[model samples]
Structures are given as C-alpha cells and as structure tokens.
Target: MPDRIRVLHVDDDPAVVEAATSALEQEHCGITVETATNVADGIERLDSEAFDCVVAGYDLPEQTGVEFLDAVRKRSPDLPFILFTSEGNEAAASDAISAGVTDYLRVDGGAEPYARLAHTVVDAVERTVDDIKHVQNTRRERAIEELHSTARAFMRATTEDAVAQITVDTARAILNMPANGVHFADGDSLYPVAWTARVEELLGTPPAFEAGESLAWQAFETGEARVHDDITSIPGRYNPETDIRSEIILPLGDHGVLLIGSCETGAFDDTDVTLARTLSVHATAALNRLDRDRQLREEREFIDQALDTLDDLFYVIDTDGSLRRWNERIPEVTGYSDEEIDEMSVSEFFPGDEHETIGAAIAETQTSGRVTVEAEILTADGERVPYEFAGTRLTDADGTTAGTVGIGRDISQRRAYERQLERKNERLDEFTSIVSHDLRNPLAVAEGNLELARTECDSDALDKVSRAHERMRALIDDLLTFARAGETATDIESVTLADIVEDCWQTVEGPRATLVVEDDRQIRADTAKLRRLLSNLVRNSVEHGSADAQTPSGHTAEHDGESITVRVGIVEDADRHGFYVADDGPGIPEDDREQVFEEGYSTGENGTGFGLKIVQRLAEVHGWTITATESEAGGARFEVTGLEPA
Candidate 1:
C-alpha cells in the first residue's frame, strides 16, 4: 500500500549515516531514508521495521558489514543492500563484495562517496520495485486467463453440478487461495453445493447458515464482496482458533455465492473483487439455462403419459408414414403390438378398398392444418373393421407440417352384423322369384281347370275334370313345399341324411323302377327340408328318365336291369360328399344342364321344372352348394358340395 520506498542506512559512524541520508535524499527514486548508527542498532532496526534498500559500512567496531549483510540476507533475502566503506579498506571491501553485497563505495574526501552510495541505493531500489511489479503483472494476467477458461467451461456445462465445480476450480486458481467453493442459495440460506479437496481437508464441513447466519450469506444478500484478513485473529472468522489467516466471499448473483479462504493475511485485494463480479454473470446465465431444461423435460413426460392412456390406436408418424410414437391402446384396437406397428406402414393397416381414402385424408389434413376422419380399415387379423380415424398435422416452429398424429377405434362387430343383413336381403330376392315362377303357375292352372269344370258337359267331362283337378292339386302341393325350402333354418340339426333318402325312396310311386341307395358319411341338416329335397329329386328323375326314354345326346341307354335303373348313391368329389341321383337312361342335353336347376326350366314332356330348382334352393339354404353335371350312367348328376357337417 506504500507509495514511497523506505531506505535504511546502517554504518558505524553517525556522521557517515548523516552524510549518506543527505546525499541519497536528493535522488528522486521515491525513497524515504531511516538511519542506524551501528551493526547492532541496524540489526535491531531491521528486525523492528521494513525497508526497500539498506546502505551499510564494511569495517565496524563490533561487527563487519559482511556479517551484517549475511544477517540481512538471512532475514530478508530479496531486499537490496549496499556497502559504504573507507578508502583504505579495499581488502575488507573486496571480501564484503564477494559475500554478496549489493554495491560498494569508497569515501576518499568530501561528499563524493555518500553521493555515489545514494546513487547505488537508488538503482537497487528501482530494480527491486521493477521486479515486484513484474511478478504482480504476471499474476494478474494468469488470473485473467483462468477466468476465461472457467467461463468457457461454464458455457459447456449442461448441469448444475458441472457449473458449480467449474466455479470452485476457477476461484481457487485465480484467487491463489485455499479452501475455495461454491454455495447455492436455498430459500433464505446459502449452503455448500460444490467445493475443492482443500476445502474439505482444511475448512472441514461447511456450516449451515440462514439469511444472516454467516459472513458469506450476509455478503451475498448485500451484493458487496467481503474479506476476512485473519481468521485466527478476527472475531467473526469461521474458526478463530485455527491457523487460517484470511478469506474472500463474493456473491454469485441471485442464485449462489463463492467462498475463498487463504493462509496469508490480507491476501485478497480489488483484483479479486473485479474477477468475482465478472464470474457472477456467467454463473447466472448457466443457472437460467438449467431451469429451462428441467421444465422442458417435465413437459415431455406429461405428454407421453397422456397419450399412453388413451383408448385408441394413436400414432405419431413422419410424412412418409414411418412410425415415430405409439400409444398403449394401439395394440388393443388394431390387433398389432407396439413392436409390430413400428415396422408396419400406415397404408398396410388399411383395407385394400379403403387404403386410398385414408391416404387422401392424411394428405388433406397435412395441407390444410386441420383434422381429418376416415372409416374402414383392414385389421392385422385380415378382418374388415369399421374405423373412425382422425388425424391432425403437427407443425414445427417454422410452420411446416413435420408429421401427422392420428387415432382410430375398432368397429368390426358392427360391420359383421351389417354383412349378415345384406345376405338376408339376397335370400329374400330369391324367395320372391320362386313365388312368382313356381307358386303362381300352379295356382293359375287350378283356376283354369275349375273354370272348365263349370262349363263342361256329360260323363267324359267328369273324368277329364277329375284328371285336371288331380294334376292341379299335385302342382299346388309341390309349389308350397318348394317355397318353404328357401327360408333359413336357425336350428342346426345334426340329422342322419340317410334316413331322409330312405324315406323319399319308400314314398316314390315308380313301380317299374329299381331303387339302388348307397350311403357313407352322415350330414347335418333340417330333416324335413332334406326329405323334401330328396323327394323332389327322386320323383323328377323317375318321371324324366322313363323306361322308354331316349338320349338327348343321341347315345343309347345301357342298363343292367330289364327295367329303368334309378341309382341314388354317395360319392366323393374333391372335399365334398353328396348323394347323386344317377339313372341308366339318356343323359340330359349339354345345353340344358345349367338351365335345368333355374326356376321354370324343364326337360321332360309333362315335367314341372320346380323339382331341380327346389333342389338347388334347398342346397343353398342349408349352407350347401350344388352343381348339375352329366353322370357316369349317361343321366343327370346333381353334385351338391359344401355338405360338411357344422
């Protein structure tokens, strides 16, 4: 803190000290001189006070100046010392010079030696001051470099702990102090968050302090840097009994504080204060960034939880439909787990018929920045499930739609019920056709016959009328029975189809026909409908392929019997087994094979075509499928497939 340098003159003669002071005082090297008359007094003065330079005489009454130089060197090795000697004592002077004295001057006459001694002291003092200034400049530059390094680290740090550590390391290195650390402000208190190894070893555990408990907290609250010059001597020092000498506590803005303790007394000055103030700005910025990062992480977690609990097939997809995010309920609704859905394309999840509609809806939503809705999707199980799909375009901060978010729920059961309803309507159309063609024809014939009977004459009229009436009654009965065959039977009866076939055979009135029946597999069907179907087929075959019948194909009929052979037998064709009515008469014409089963189409002279039509209708109504083809016996073959028991 001293602006003027202090020079001490030590000589055996008082007149010499006086002459030296007068000579050195005029030199403006910024020195204030203090005189000591002898080696003993000089030793006392050197122990008692401080000075920048010393001027001593070589030969003394009690001790030599060389010995005094040794004492000075022992006490203050860095202080500059000069020797002023008698002109005749060159031997002692040379010895003194060899012993490492700063400069030597011989007084021959007048005041020349004193003036030269003053000159020597001034030069040594100037050199010592320059050396001190150079050391201080070096220290200041190092502190600045450390601060810059710490600021870079602070900028690079991503967490509070990392920032706190950087602060502590920088404080210790820049301040050249021991027990350096950072303290965080929690409510009204400042607590140690991070500290160096010296802090733990020398300072021990940090003390807990509220708003005004410690000097550090007080300094932080007041926004003023505080210094403790000597902890061992100061009343408010952390450990007044220990060897700790000084400390500097600085505020790190509104969030925290830094504490720097030193072993040297009065160590920190204005330079440390400037450094702390600069570092606080960087610390505040780091803390602000940390707070924002924490908030963003919390927000993301909340959004994820909300999406996961939603009961729909929710997804976040890139513009190309690569999956980005998936919710928990996607698996439940779409029959695809998260692992499976991630690999699937958005179009892959839609029905073959509805894929384009969904893709268009997504494109529209992306372009318009609005939600879109689409129905119908093909599920992972290959079912056409009705879906209510909605999407929204997710935009980035630059207002470009980066992706699409969508939700969908399953409606498969509802779609299945609607399909079942459509099938029922188709059956109703079949029923209407049957009534118009089969039922109306028979009723018209009956009405015509009755009109004829009312107007006819004599005995021939009664017989002809009886014949016409009987024919009308048979046709009417057959029409009613065939009409009932089209109705769906809900009761799935597992009846033996062989019993119905045998019953139909027993009822047939073909006396000249030989009935050959063969059975193997059992069938599940309505017994009444099966009986009606078998009776119609057997009766039609008997009437159509008479014993004297000729082939439409112009091929002769071959039979093993003298009579017309009617063969009803079970045969295997692909995956289906059915009883085929085969006769050893002429086969049906190739042109009439398909038309024979169509309503109101016939091949016989007096045949009502309802027989073959009823067979096809009943087969379909029972969930069975039938086809008409030529039999091996050169007669008609009705092969009814889909006859497997449910």
Candidate 2:
C-alpha cells in the first residue's frame, strides 16, 4: 500500500472526465485521477501505466463500460474495476455486474456522487492489495518449512550426485524457479551435473564453464552469490545468445555452484537470494560429509586387504567376547561363513575344557595389555586343530578397555614335529645306554687282554693292535655326543666371552696353541650349552689346525708349524651382533666351508668329524646362526651371530 492511489477515469464527455478527476482528487487526499475520453483511450492508458483502480463511464465511443471491463479482465484479473454510468437502468446495472466489475455506480448530477465513486474505488483497491499480501505471506511460511525438509534430505544424502539433484529440485519446487542447474567444481572447470527438465526444454543443455569463462566460475572462486536481473546486458556471458533473462549464481563453498535462471527479466527478488543461500549451505555440508566418508572407506578397505593377506586369522573382539570384526582368513581357516562367525563368540571356537583358559587369557590381556595362549581350535567340521593365539588389549578414545585385537596361527605342524622329536629322543637314550654299558664292558675286557699280551711279547703288530683299539674308543665317544646334540637348551644366563674362552682353552690339550682374547662382550645363553660349544671348537682348532698334529686317537702326524694362534673376539655389523673364533692354521677352502659343518665330514685322518657339527647344532638350539669363513691371518673363522645381549 503506497501513499498515493491512482485511478483511470474513462467517459465519453470531456466535461464528465474533467469533473470526475477533480472530484476524486479533492475527495481523498491520497487519490489521483487521470481522464480518458473513450474506452479505447482508457484501455491504452491501463496497458501503458500502473494504476490501482479503473473507473469507466457506461457509454463510450467504441464500446460500453461493460466491454471495457471485459478488456481489463483479460490483462489484470485481480485489478479493481468500477463502472460509473449516467444510464441508471436495470439492464445496464445487470450487464455491468455480469461483466465482473468491482462496483457499479450511477453518475448522478452532483459532486457528491463523484465523491462516493472515489471512496468506492479506494476501498476496492485496498482489499485487492490486502488479499495479495495475505497470499504472499502464506507462501513464504510454506517455503521456509519446505527448506527445513530439504535440510533433512541433505543429511540422508550419501553421495555428491544425490545432493546435487536435490538442490536442483528444491530450487524448482520451493523457490519457484524452474530453469535451474547445479555445477560441481572439477579441476579447473565447473561442469553441469544436475538440472531440471524445464531447463533442458528451454536451453537444451547448459554449457560447462572453464576457468574465467562465465560469472558462475567467478562466484565459485570468490565464494559469493551473484544476482543478474538481466543477463543479456551483462558482458562476457557464457552463452551470449541465450534466452535466459535473469540468473542467480550461488557458491557452495569449495564444492561447486548452484544456478537458477528465468526467462522474465527481474524475476527473482531479495527473498529468492536468501532462500538460495540456505540451500547452498546445506548442499556444501552434505558434500563435505560425503568426501570424508569416502576417505574413511578407502582407508578401511586398505587395512582389510592387509589383514587378509596374512596367513593367520586376524580378529577384533569386544569385551563381552563377541566378534566385532575379522579378516577373510578367519572364515577360510575355520570353514565358517562370515555370517556364522559374526554370531559366534570367541570362546565358541575352542573346546569346552579350553574355554576357561581362554577366558583367563583375555582377562589377563585386559589387565596387562597383552597375552598369548596355545589351544586346539574346534573347527566347524569337528576337527580339533592346535592353534597359538596372541592378543593385545584395545582401548577407546577415553582410554577405556574396549576389547582385544589379535591373531591366531595354526600350530598343528609344530605339534607334529614335537611328537617326532620326542620319539627320536627316546631312541637316542636307548642307544646311549648301550654304548655306555654294553659296549664299554666288552671293550674293557679287550684292553685287559691286550695289556697281558703286551707283557708277553713286545712287537710292532701289538702296537698296531693298540692303536686300532684307541680309534674304536674315540669313534664310540663321538657317536654318543652326536646322538645327544639335538637336545634343546633349558637354562639361559649371561656369560662373558673372554672368561669362557680361557676356560675352554685350559680343557683342550692344545700345548702349542696360544689363545688370544681380542674383544670381550657379555652374551645371554644356556651356560652348559655355551661351554660345550666353545670346548668343541677349541679342541677342533688344536687337533687339526697345524700341518703336523696328533689325531684324537693319539696317532702322531707330521706338521710344518710348531704353534697356532686362536683368537676370540666380538663380531658386530649392521644386521647382526655376536662373537667369532678364528685360528691361524690351514684355512678351510671356500668350496669345503659348507661341507665342514656336515656330520662325519673331516679333513684329518684321525679327527672326529662330529665336533663342528655339534657346534652348529648348539648354536641353532639358542636361536643363533654360525658361519665358516677365512680369518684375517689366513685361517679358519667361525662366527656365531644373532645373540641376545646381557
């Protein structure tokens, strides 16, 4: 409602038009009347200018007041129209009423009638404006509610494409803009991703905007909303020949831009911009959520792949023993489907007797942060397979114990090997008893007979017989030592290298060999096994190292050297740390280094070949490795690596 009310007064007489104008303007301060001499002139004025109400006389040059009212109804149906005529007949009043006039007034010859007409016009126009306002207010309230609904839909949208489609649809239905589209930013350009069907019908297909190509990119880069009342007047338009007269471009953060267009100029107002901005905010939030979800999904997929690649079963269990997540290996090894495993508890995979042990282990893990246990897994096919499971407790963000993450490895092959080793050890014990008791008794009787024969006849043949007996005794002792070499070490302790080397040197009968302790380091090992390993290596170096040396059976041989130096020192490298024993004697050839460790492989005639083999076996029992190489003094070197520091 404005301060001034404009009315169009149409009449056939000039005097009546002038009198009507003066009366209407003088009656109401807010009223202004413009006069037209005929119906055609009044209709022309109504089309060309804005007027609040139309006042026409019953008689005109080309048409009557009813005819003029019909013409006005075709253009502005809600505009207030009044028929003021001098002919106050029943027929004229009926026609005017039928023609949909706002009010029918008779032009009585008085200034009061004009005054009455002016008041009627003013009342009609005010009612029309009030009705229009009411409708607009109702529509605005409904639009706001619909926008709220759109926000909920955005929350449910899991993909960017879905958000784009909803944005375009919302602009068309709620904002009342049919020609709309959504453009997403891809690299250095904006591509149209979604649009309404009406948009296609109007402009076929919208063009994509490259960098600096259109106003859409400008708004997207600047994160601003732009409203173009008449796009035709704008320079550097994406489509200069396009039919769209008005456009609104809104930026959706860094994700993209939303475009709304119309064929009529100045179609969108301030309210449209405000509503569009709300929609843009919702769409941007949804897109950002979708982006984060995609990244998390990819990372989870990568972790799953890594877990599946493992040979053992990997799982995540809750505090209540329910399986929360598992790798593919679990299903493959247990012969259970993923769905079945999901419903199964952690204790259900083990036997009834083992359930208590597993529960204890899990409780310990929760307390100590880690636990390991070995139990037989009862598979779906009813087969009991031994498995060793290790678990570490998991915690939530608040540092509360959530559950356990762990791996279970099949130990069936290990169990089989252990059973085989037990059988071998039993047979070895039986053989050891035979060699110590049964063989030694007969050998002692032979030695007594040989001593008696030596007293009777002192001859060269008797010397040969004594040497043969000594060789037999040495072979039997070596056989017994080799048989028991595979036994695992039980007690582990720290021992200094220099002290062990000195003790072993005294035990070995190496009178012409000098022991050199270069660098000493403390190592963790079984004390008895480490002593045995060092004693065997020192004996081998003294007996066979020199060119001329006696065999273990007391047979003398020729040699060129009188003394050999044996060095014991630490060996440290980037990948390994341990100690080495080297002898300045005839170094083993590279071709025979690997064969020297084999049982019954020796270079000297009278040397017991089981010494080096026993050294290797003892090193392996301690989870260490030994290698034979050339020493710095052109001699044999034995390195024991992978030791645990004291």
lDDT of each: 0.74, 0.86
User: Whole-model lDDT for model 2 versus the true structure?
Assistant: 0.86
* Candidate 2, superposed: residue stretches over 4 Å from native: 1-141, 221-236, 263-268, 301-309, 328-348, 448-457, 460-462, 544-563, 642-646
Model 2 lDDT at residue 201: 94
Candidate 2 residue-wise lDDT, 282-385, digit = tens? 88999989989999999999999999999998999998899999999888878999999989999888889899999999999999999999998888998888
RMSD of each: 22.7, 6.7
Among all candidates shown, the one with the greatest TM-score: 2
Candidate 1 segments whose C-alpha is farther than 4 A from its true place = 1-3, 8-13, 34-166, 169-175, 193-197, 200-202, 227-242, 269-289, 312-315, 319-321, 324-354, 375-390, 405-646
Backbone clashes, candidate 2: 3
